[model samples]
Target: MAAHFPINHHLRPLYRLLSALAGLYMLVFGVVGFVQTSGAEFFTRDEAEWVLGLRTNPAFSLLSLVAGVVVLGANLIGRNVAHHINQLAGVVLTVVGMFSLAVMQTEANVLAFSMVNVIVTFILAAVTGIASLYDRVGSLTAARAEEAHRHSARVA
Candidate 1:
């Protein structure tokens, strides 16, 4: 859709790739979480162990699974839906990253790895945010053009 509005094709691929990867990441995480909760034992102790129980939160896990699926499905849809999906994904990642950082600091004894994840997730969030804006702008241009065409056709 943005093709008529001077889009950077280079950016589209990047956005789609990031969205897809993020989706895949969440999908895998959800499946793993489900499995882990259904009686698989992990040898962990204390703070980290305590937080492991938090992963069993039905709300968080379900949200993760649904968000991942919605994001991936949006990519596969038409332009308007894709734009909105990218926007939502960006917001989710940004907030989730910040929350993860806070949780890691407070809930775990050794937060080195968690901190790394937080940093990476934040970067992903930033990239998605920019991409979302670009896509939305492009879609807006396309929509206006379509509207103009419809008006002209009706008048003719």
Candidate 2:
């Protein structure tokens, strides 16, 4: 599976940019959500409260804020660290989204997550995961070798 993944991909910069944008969006959404729901209980399941078309509560807003900070911080650090962070974050987000979806209609929906929130979470997870796949850095020779190997594998 690792052999099939790209190394030093030409579009790495674009992927990084998209991931950074996603982080920014998350940060902004979290701040707005936090402010909007400040008066509500931390885990309130109120569907009336919304931020950027997504239901939110204090707990979810705080979690989002932390996630955004971690993602943006990793991007700033760059190198393999960012790659690892993106990969982990993607999986975590997917799991959280799934869990939220499961409890969405029940009293267990502490995050106040709606279907739209889950959708956005999944989208962000995909963006980060794709970025991770191509975010590796290596010497020119290594990259060339990897590309050649990939090309030959495709031809075979």
Candidate 3:
């Protein structure tokens, strides 16, 4: 009898959920951007002011929408693309979110607000990235093990 942690530790599901949440949040954000780009203001003026500030650059808005959709795709479709690729994509999403914040900081009026968003985005990205990477590693390892087992069986 050895004291050993379970193979599927507490972190695995945590990561999956985190990645899922990251994707879900991005999906919502993207939808909002898309809506705004189409001249739809779904938010109260106060709330919109609190977040988006005054300017509505259609190009930046479109970028936000596109990025959100891409991040969501990375989280959901990573596993399908090869485990390593999925993990890398998660990391990419995290970096992109943070990078977008820096880009926002360059704006004339919304420096502080954009920085705040940057912080939030970075946190989500890191959490989801770690989880996604962990999942990818586990999946790849399992796949390799299964492949090895199949090879042995074939040789027998």
**RMSD to the hidden true structure, all candidates:** 8.4, 2.2, 9.2
The TM-score obtained by model 3 is 0.53
**What tens digits encode model 1's per-residue C-alpha lDDT throughout 1-156?**
233322334367667667767676666655555454434333222322112223333333445567678777776663657677777778988988777677665534232225555676676577656666555434557667655654564433
Name the candidate that leads on TM-score.
Answer: 2
Candidate 2, 23-131: lDDT as tens digits: 8888888899898888888888854388888888888888888899888888877777788888998999889889988988998888988899999999999989888
Clashing pairs in 1: none
Q: For residues 1-156, could you state the per-residue lDDT of candidate 3 as single tens digits?
A: 332212333455566666667666655655555556455343222223222332333343455466556655665664433234335545765675566655654543222235555566666657655664455433557656644654564333
Q: Give the TM-score of candidate 2.
A: 0.89
Candidate 1: segments with Cα more than 4 A from true spot: 1-10, 40-60, 107-113, 137-156
Runs of candidate 2 with Cα error greater than 4 angstroms are 1-3, 153-156
The pairs that clash in candidate 2 are: none
Candidate closer to the true structure by lDDT (higher is better), 1 or 2: 2
**Candidate 3 CA-lDDT value:** 0.50
